[model samples]
Target: MSGITTSFFLIFAGAAVVASLALYTRQPLIIAYIVLGAVIGPYGVEWVTDLKLLADIADVGILFLLFLLGLDMQPRALIDTIQKSTVVALLSSLAFASLGIGIAFLFGFTLVECLVIGAAMMFSSTIIGIKLLPTTVLHHKHTGELMIGLLLLQDLIAIFVLLLLMAFGLGEFSIMDFSLTLLSLPLFVAAAFAAVRWIVLPLLRRFDRFHEYIFLVALGWCLGLAEAGHALGLSAEIGAFLAGISLATSPISQYIAVNLKPLRDFFLILFFFSLGARFDLGLIGEVLVPAMVLATTMLGLKPVIFRYLLHGLSERNSLAWDLGFRLGQVSEFSLLIAYMAAGSAIIGREASHLIQATTIITFVVSSYIIILNYPTPIAISDKLRRD
Candidate 1:
């Protein structure tokens, strides 16, 4: 218990100090959190060695993040965005996946390793993309809609990739298993919608007057659906996202979304911290060359590919370029896939390290580029910063 207390103290205290310094230095606060994790984590000063506990808690950040995203958009808008962005998302995913596969093969990795790495490369960082976008821009701008739609589509693909990895992990990668897995997704989505329509929405309608109760119920509903997803062999993230989408039509959705931002940030800080803490710094040297090559390639290629794809879809050149830059990074999901694959012995440590190092590098570099060249909430220049 004391250890847990000490860990929390270190995390918050470190975050406060580092975040302040980041603000002063015009750096992304997210980098501060990750650096804090690496500095005090087991491999560093060994101040917070309980990596599993931190990781479990940190996952809630992603859940709430998705939940808020759903609340922000109406169901119709979400559907429209998905419909419009599907082609761009699919094309960009294929391009990035091929790049990853080719690079991994060039480095002498096995076919399975190449495939896993390729799948991991198909996503952009939703957290970074959304968190930095101003709320006003997100709600009113076409760029935001495109970014959100593309990210959501990518997230769906990531879920399927994760499921495939899980099936492989369990040694059940048969044709029947794959078909059943695909079938379960639609069934689970149907069940989620049905429950929301019949039960959850009614409860919310009846209890709307009670603010505290509304908050509690909303939280419970989110977590409950997340657990249900896990039970049904889906990720908790997908479940939480569906929970938010189900509530998007309700009048109280805005209130819930607003109140939950602080909570979401809290968990996200922990998530980033755990991400850094879990990384084995010793393995970095072994994968440094490949990681640099991969990171540089991704940073260069993603923007060009996305810009061309969005332009082909009739988006304005300026908007397409901005959207491309915003998404020009490997995702946190990439790290999750690498972690799971390595843990399951599906990929070697070197492959895992390559993914981790490249992700971190891209994250850092992408943040700098976006803040410097585009409008973000945390831009250094007053002219570029938007509320």
Candidate 2:
């Protein structure tokens, strides 16, 4: 059996077990996924070997994730997302990044290492936030809207950083190159959007009559555009997202989503499992103090910064607190940032591993915290409002 095939079986078996446990305990299944990964990983009973193919599939998972996010977005929503959440995301990200870098500096990490650590800490996991959101609440409340907005902001920031990293070479950064790269974003997006509308849409519309054809067309558009984006020095995630958005108005969008769910789930499991198995516990051990320091800062300080941002926007303290508590954990994109930075050699393996470890720890802890306290926080807000 192929290594990737074995890994998929293991992940599927793990997910099934976690699903049962999550149902029994009334907890999120995502936590179960992480815990399962840890249990069957290199640190545990060694089962799977080949990770390269799984890693590649995980990349597809990321593309689908971005695509789904875009599918949920509407053009009219951008103004509101930016106005409500842009400043909040930015301020929160800056505060977390600063705290992360400061802790790294205090722990005697190099300047480059500190920079990478800080940058990695700036993003929060849109995937978790979106997946965990109550669909009922999302369709009803201001808080849900704010959460969605915040996630969109974080996604944009992550994409920009990815673009920057891709544009830069092995040597030090260049102002001219950076300027050119930034200028190219809108052009690339515009061109992609235009091509999708004028060319891709017609072909997809015809193919929509056949279920197999619809699925193939959707996948082809996503992958084809992703490849085109890579060729043009943009992240494939960007193209995949745009592809989803382009198809959002089509009647076949829902069909595509339904068809893609199993594939997405399968690959996403690989993505998360690979994330866990690839972690360098040795480096984490070496940088134990720094890792702990950074984790503490994220857990302690991020919420406070977000609370302040919310309060500044005239939100009630209690509501701000709920929002803060919900967003306190570092995002999944933080891992992606670390992975990219490590791959690019912008930071050492230890620094990247430290960030990833902190992220996983924070994600597990924060998910529990929010799940437990969500109702209490909302109730407290209502009490405060009445008072």
TM-score against native, each model? 0.96, 0.86
lDDT of 2: 0.73
User: Per-residue CA lDDT of candidate 2, range 1-387, in tens?
Assistant: 777677778888878988798867766566777777667777556675565666787889878876765655554664575687778888887887788888889877799888778888887676555555554554346776687678767777776776666545265667786577557767876776787678777887766567787777778888887887666656687678777776766666767776786787777777767777666555666867776777777878777888899999998898788778778888777887888888988787888888888888888777777666664221223332110
RMSD of each: 1.4, 4.5
The segments of candidate 2 whose C-alpha lies over 4 angstroms from its true place after superposition are: 25-27, 137-145, 163-169, 315-319, 375-387
In every candidate, how many clashes are there? Answer: 0, 3
Off by over 4 Å in 1: none
Indicate the residue-level lDDT of 243 in model 1: 88
- Local accuracy of candidate 1 as per-residue lDDT tens digits, 1-387: 698899999999999999999999988888899899988998788999999999999999999998888777777887898899999999999999999999999999999999999988999999889988888888767777778899988988987898888888987777786677667878887887888889888888887888898899889989988888777767787788888888888878898998999999999999989888988888888898889999999999999999999899898999989999899999989998999999989999899989999999898899889989888888889999998
